[model samples]
Target: MTHTIAVAPQATKHPGPLGRRPAPQSVAELLLRAEALEGFTVAQLAAALKLELPLHNRRAKGFVGGLVEQALGADPKARTQPDFPALGVELKTIPIRPDGTPLESTFCCAIAMGRADRASWEASVLRRRLDHVLFVAHLAVKDTPLAARRFARPVLWRPTPPQWQLLQQDWEDLMGKIGAGQSGHLAANVGEILQVRPKAAHRQVRTWGHGPDGPQAVHPLAFYLRARFTRSILRQQG
Candidate 1:
C-alpha cells in the first residue's frame, strides 16, 4: 500500500513565535563585546581540535556559545540589553538530509535557573531563558561569536535538571520531525520530546535491496545518539 505523506510548508515559513533574532554584523565585534564567553573562540577551539569546520558552522558554534554565555552572565551596564538568567546553554546543528538543500540552522538554549525570591534576577533570567534559542539561532547564521564589548561581565556557567529536560525535548522533537519527512527547514518551536509517535505504528514498510538483507529498522543506536548527546551537553553544564 502507498501512503502519501504531506510535506508541510511550515518548515519554510517562519512562524511568528518561532523566529530567530538578528544576525551579528561582524564576527570581530561579536568576539569583543559578548560578556558570556569564557575566552575560547570558535576558530581557536577548532584549531586546537584539528577539525576543519565549514565557515558557517564555525561561526555558528562560536556565536551560539557566546549567546548562551550571555544568558548565564548578564551585564549590569547594558541595562537596555535583554537579560538571560539561565544557568547554562549549549549549541547544536540540524542538517538537511538531501544534498544541495540548505539544512535548517539553529542553536538550542537550555535554561537551568529556577525563579524563587530573586525577583529582579528572575525577570532578567526569564527573558533570557525564553528567548535564548531565538538569540543564539540568530547569531549562528552570521558566523560570529558574541562581542565582549557589548557585554559588561563574565562567568563560568553550569546547567541543572530543568535545563536537561529542555534539551532532551528539543532534540527529540527535531529528530522526530525530520524522521517523519518534515524537511526543507525547521523552526525553533518544534518542542515535543522524540518518542514513538502515534503514526509510527502505521509506517509503510519497504524492503531494502542491499545484498541478501531485507529492510530492517536501522540500529536503535542512531536514535540513541540523540539521548547520548543530551547527556553529554548536560555534563558540560555541570
Candidate 2:
C-alpha cells in the first residue's frame, strides 16, 4: 500500500482551530487544534489532506495516528522524544469498540531487557513516553473498512499519584525479575497495570536478554498499558 505525507496549511499570528500552525507552540494550541478533528471521518480527513488511504488492514495500523500528527503539524517521522517535544506531550491514537471500550493495549516502548540492572522506573523509556498524553479515540469495529471509522474528541491526561505509584511498582517488579535472570519466565499476566509482551513485527525478530547461561537471544519485548488502565482513563474523562 502507498502512504502519503499530508502537509498542513500555514497559520496566521492569531489562528483559529482549523488554521493553527502545523506544530502547535503550546499545550492549549495543541488541544484547540485536536478538538477541531472531533467528528471527522477517516475518508473526510484523507480527502481534506489529499492523502491516500491504505488498502489492507495490517498496513493501516498507524494510519490514524499519522493523520492526527499531520493535521496538528507534527513531524511524520518517529522521534526519540515526545511528538510535541517542546511541550513534552505524546500523541496516542486509541481504537475504541462500539461500546466505548479500548480495543487493545496501549504500546509504551521497547524494553531494554539486557540493561535491566541499570534501569530505573523514574528514568525508564516507558515513563518518559507516558509523562503526558493526548488521546484521540477512534471508533473501530471488527471487520469494518478503515475509512468508516470516526474520530472522537481528544482527551489530555496525566497519571494520578496513585496510578503512577502502581505503575512504578509494576516496572520495578518486572525489572527485578529481569535482573534475576528470569526474563524467559516473564509472562503477559505478570503485572497489574502494565504488561510485557513481544513487540517485533514477527516472532523471528530477537534481542539480547539475561539468561541462566548469560546473555541469550529473546523476542524483543515492549511495555504496554493494560486495557483496564486505559478504560479507566476513558471513564474518568467521561
Candidate 3:
C-alpha cells in the first residue's frame, strides 16, 4: 500500500534540525554524526528534523543527499567546492540496489564541454572534487518508496595509487576527446573508472562545445564514477 508521509509544519523555517553554525570539526565527528542516521528512514529523519520529504522520487533525487548534509551539520551554501570546505571533503550519497551493486554511476559535476579542451588533470575541477569524498550508501530496492530506504555506514575515502591512475587515465582520455571536437562520439563505455555522460533532464537541453567551425551546440555532460569502481570501494571498506 502507498503512504503519504506527513510534512512538518515548521519545515519551511527550520529546514534542518541542526542549525547552521558549528559544523563538524573533523572527519571523525562527521562520521559519528552520520552513524546516528544509520537506522532511520528518510521520512523519519525528515519528520525529526521538521523537514518535508519529497512528494515524488524523480523530484527527490537529491533529498537523501540533503538529509546527509543536514545530519552532518554541513554548510548550507551550495558551492562548487566540497560540502565541507574547511575539511576538504565532498559528500556523496550512493544508491545501491538489492544485490549490493550501485543503481547508477555517481555524478561528479557538470562539465563545460567547450572548456574541457583546455583542462588538465592536475587542474581539473573533477579531480579536486573527488580528491576526498564521504560516501553514504543507501538501499534502493525496486518498488520501494523514497522514504523507506535504509542507509549503510558512511565511509571517507581517498583513492589508492592504482585507483588514482585509472581515474587519471580516464580523465585524460575523455578530455582529449573533447579537445579533438569528438565529444559527440563519447559514450558510457569510454572509461573504466570514470565516464562522461549526458546530464540534462531533457533531450533538447544543450550546452556549448567545440565544433569544426567553432563553438557549437551539444548535449550537456557530467563526469561520473562507474558503479564497478564504487563497488570495489565498498569491498575495500568492508
Candidate 4:
C-alpha cells in the first residue's frame, strides 16, 4: 500500500529534513536534495510536467523523507538492498495552478547522496538503475471544466524499476518518431507508447493548503512526462 504524505498548509516547508543536501554525483546527495523541497516551494519540479501547482495551504514537510528515499533508489523505509538497488537521489515537491498550467517561475532543489555503482558501496546494487533520472510532476482531474481543475501537489519522481523500463521504451519510440520526421510530436506519446495508466480515475485528495481538493486522477509518472520533458527526460529526449 502507498502511504500518502500529510498535507499541512501551515506546516513549514523544510528543504533539509535529512540535513545537508546531496551532491549531483552522489546518489544520496541527489536524493536528499530532492527530498528537501515541498509543493509550495519547488516550482522547477512541477514545471517538468508542463503544469502548475496551486499554493493554497501548500506548505508541507512530510514528503521530504519519503521522496528522498525514493530518489536514492531506496524504499520507503530509506534502506537500500541488493534486490532493491538504490541510487542516491533527491525529490522536490512543489505546487501548480488550478488548471494544471505552469507559472513563470518555480523552484526546487536536488542533492546527491551515495554512489550506486561502486563495488565498495553500501547501498543496494541494481545493475540497471536510472542513477540519474529526475522527475517533475503535475496532477489534475483527467477531464472536466478546465478552470475547475485546479493545480495539484507536484512531486519529484525518480524512476523506479517498473517505470524505468517504460521510459527506456519511450525513449526508443521517441527516437523512432523523430527519425521518421513526424510532426506534432510531444513527450505525451511516451505515455501512450508505454501504456502507462493511472492507478486511479476521477479521484481527489484534500491537501493541507486551501486550494481545491486533490485531482480526480493521478498518473504514476505522467506529470513529469505526460507531454513534457523532465530534467532527466530532457537529457535523453533527443
> Scored by Cα lDDT, where does model 4 land?
0.32
Q: Estimate each model's TM-score.
A: 0.24, 0.87, 0.87, 0.31
Each candidate: RMSD to true structure? 18.6, 7.2, 6.4, 17.5
In the predicted model 2, the residue pairs found to clash are 22-73
Local distance difference test scores for all models: 0.30, 0.77, 0.77, 0.32
Model 4 lDDT tens row, 1-238: 3223322242243233232223345554553443343333333333332334444422222233233333333444433322123444433333233333332122221111111012221221221223443443323324532223222233334556766666556544543433233312334334432322222233352212111232222112111334223322323321
lDDT of 3 by residue, 1-238 (tens): 3221211122123223553336889988887777666656677777666678888898556888877777777777746778888888888887876455778889998887888778888878788888988888777778999887777766679988888899899999988888778888897899988999898989899888977567899888889999888877765673
Q: Looking at model 2, report the run of 10 residues with the lowest lDDT sum.
A: 3-12
Per-residue accuracy of model 1 over 88-155 as CA lDDT, tens digit each = 22222222211111123232222211211122322433334333321221112233332211111121
**What TM-score does candidate 1 get on C-alpha atoms?**
0.24
- Residue by residue across 1-238, what tens digits does model 2's lDDT show? 3221121232222222332236888999999878777667776776667678998867665987777777887754546577888888888888887556788898888788789867888778778778998888877878878887777767888988998899999999988888767877898899999998888889898788888777888777788999878877876763
lDDT of 1: 0.30
Please give the TM-score that candidate 4 achieves against the real structure: 0.31
TM-score of 2: 0.87
